[model samples]
Target: MSSTRQFSFEFFPTKTDAGHEKLMQTAAHLATYNPNYFSCTYGAGGSTRDRTIDTVKHLNDVIKVSTAPHLSCVGDTKADLRQLLTMYKNSGINRLVALRGDLPSGMGMASGELRYANELVEFVRKETDDHFTIAVAAYPEMHPQARNFEEDLRNFATKVKAGANIAITQYFFNADCYFYFVERVRKLGIEIPIVPGIMPITNYTRLARFSDACGAEMPRWVRKQLEAYGDDTKSIKAFGEQVISEMCERLLQGGAPGLHFYTLNQAEPSLAIWENLKLPR
Candidate 1:
């Protein structure tokens, strides 16, 4: 990896005190690596907006890390988003992951004020005038709901043209998928850094479910191997670290800008992968 490449972790707001405590512990541990930033995810349809803001503030104040809070367009009005942008700017939180997040369960898309992430990016630029560094999502394996690969690439390009400064992809097992996606985007004249998202495979069942839901492909070989480990948590984690670390190595060596880990609010799995790869802290 380039020494100048950026690395970050993603976390979500927790509903319970116990969950909050665990997230804090995890954040403290990962902070040791001195990541470029830590990002807090916004819940579907702005359901956990307040909690997300709280978590972002805690990380910035207590953890003392550059924090990025996700701002989604789903279930929000332009006025609501403008208010949030003002609040975050006043709080010294200048980085944002702009997304058109999933609608809350059973909520229809027609209810949302914004229909796409590109629009959100545009609105942010119009409102803030470069006050924030905006990060947007890239789906290497084509978004599940996209009409086709070409359409997905076009959608991603739109976000970049609308003023996204960076792109973080959905996790995938195959590095080739990331490479192909980057090459296709480059053909569209977009040169923004595209960081690969890494999901450490600590639990096969949960990994499979998340992959299925997000349209990330888990290679059959990897799935069968993980399945063979069955309930052996130790074996699962061991195999996961080795596999993910190797994949990360290839991604970096092949010119990936950096990595963004989907930490699932856990430290050890991602920490192990970092150590296994011998990345500089």
Candidate 2:
């Protein structure tokens, strides 16, 4: 983490060889902009663990960009987690996006050795002794599974206290939610940088589905505008670019530490928003 505002992008491990090659090309394109780091996400229960490690290694060693790999507690034993940690450490990857991952369908709640993100954070610290710069997840609008906002905030505070160095929030359209969340976190004596996650709009149908799944609100006005556009992808993209660009402006101006984009393995959509912001290359 630099004193300067950080900017990063996230990608998921693609399944097929061609898809992985294409993803590497995408990462190479984004690398031109010199993001703070590029992160690769693993599948639930570490289903795509090997692919994640490969993508991260290629991004860091081949593409020559600093890379962080996402690690989750769900569907993994402590030994499983420890082995991955050792592999990452051996590979010279120093940053991590630690999470209490979503349980796969039909998986018992009693799945992983660690139950919560705070516990995972604590485990990482105890295992690594500061070898990694751990970034945890935050929910400005509150986690979908959280019982209430207060409980969610408390959970976040617990993670911070467990030795998370920073947080990346779930994407939200409402800048106000992010500001309000930060305001409250400060009240709880937590001051780590909570970078806002940005999701560029490309396909309305896909975006809507993701929003619903993640419990991120799509403001009525935005939803209506997108619906009106229907299958007009051009208009949808233009409107999306404008809306998200403006929101990013507000977040940065309001003193947000940085942005972490959910790029969905595409370079152009996130790049369109980045170019609009005129961020340093």
Once fitted onto the true fold, the runs of candidate 1 whose alpha carbons sit more than 4 angstroms away are 1-3
In candidate 1, which residue pairs get closer than 3 Å at backbone N, Cα or C atoms, i.e. clash?
none
Clashes of 2: 0
lDDT of 2 by residue, 76-162 (tens): 899999999999999999999999987888886848789998999999999999999999999999999999999999999999999
Q: TM-score of model 2 relative to the true fold?
A: 0.98
**lDDT by residue (tens digit), candidate 1, 200-246:** 98999998998999999998998999999999999999998888999
lDDT against the true structure, each candidate: 0.93, 0.93
Q: Write down the worst ten-residue block by lDDT for model 1.
A: 105-114
